[model samples]
Target: MGILALQGAFIEHTKMLHRLGVDSFEIRQKKDLLLPMDGIILPGGESTTMFKLLNDLDMTTTIKELIQNGLPTFGTCAGMLLLAKTVDNYHSDFLGTMNIAVKKNAYGRQLGSFRTTGTFASTQNVPFVFIRAPHVTEYGDTVEVLSIVNDKIVAVREHNQLATAFHPELTTDTSIHQYFIDMCQQ
Candidate 1:
């Protein structure tokens, strides 16, 4: 697995992958994209900054193409914003591979951050940590809604793409990460 380490809680994800005994590396520049990777993780962080860095580093196209070509991917929080086709406050899309419309900061700002347990897919009582998270307002027919909180869409799976508005990496639970790994294996 290759984790985007440009910003956000990437280290937490690294630790989670490690706990699962999965070898992982960080993708920091265009050259890093050449490395073999069965899957990728876009960590939660500032969407705008990460987008800017991706473009500035000339890695935007390559990474986008990889995901579009069926590279198993898991994105959290701002990472979800990056994969979304339409973001509420943004004029344009980022990556735009996942057919989902997201409302940026739907849970309010950082001060509004909180933790809760929610039902995720077939899993029960999954830990969800939301921090300036963006919830899905709409999704395409192929998209599978996995989890919802307070009536807001917080998790979904579309083909090889898995996204969540909450930070599963921030919690001790490895089920979500394991789910992503399972996607990669297939």
Candidate 2:
């Protein structure tokens, strides 16, 4: 497994994966991507900063290739923004793998960060932490909305890719991380 360490909450995701007994490492540069990665997690942070780093590190092409070739990927918050097909205000498309349009920081600023318990798809009582998170404004037919809060789409799954607007790694629940792991195993 690999976590994009250019920015954001990569450490939190790494810790969650460790607790699940899954050996994972950080992908800090293009060289790091040389290591075999079955799955990758894009953590939450500033989308514009992540975008700049992806290009600065010259990793946009290879990372997109990996995901396009069916690497199971889980993105949270800014991760979600990067994978989105279209962003309302952002001019560039980071990955644009999923066919979803999102509004960056639709939940407001850092002060808007909050916790809520919502069902993840058919499951119940999953904890979510939203901090300047983006929500799906619209999705294509193939995209399945997994969770919604305040009537806004927060989580979605498309084939080998899974994305969440909230920071699932910030919470104690491991189901979402486990769910991504299972996807990788398949």
Top candidate when judged by lDDT against the true structure:
1
Could you estimate the TM-score for every candidate? 0.98, 0.98
Model 2 lowest lDDT segment of ten:
89-98
Q: Count the backbone clashes (under 3 Å) in each candidate.
A: 0, 0
Tens digits of per-residue lDDT, candidate 2, 10-70, equal 9999999999999999999999987998899999998889989999989999989899989
What TM-score would candidate 1 get against the native? 0.98
List candidate 2 stretches off by more than 4 Å: none
lDDT of 1 by residue, 128-150 (tens): 99999999999999999999999
Indicate which candidate wins on TM-score.
Answer: 1
**Model 1 ranges off by over 4 Å:** none
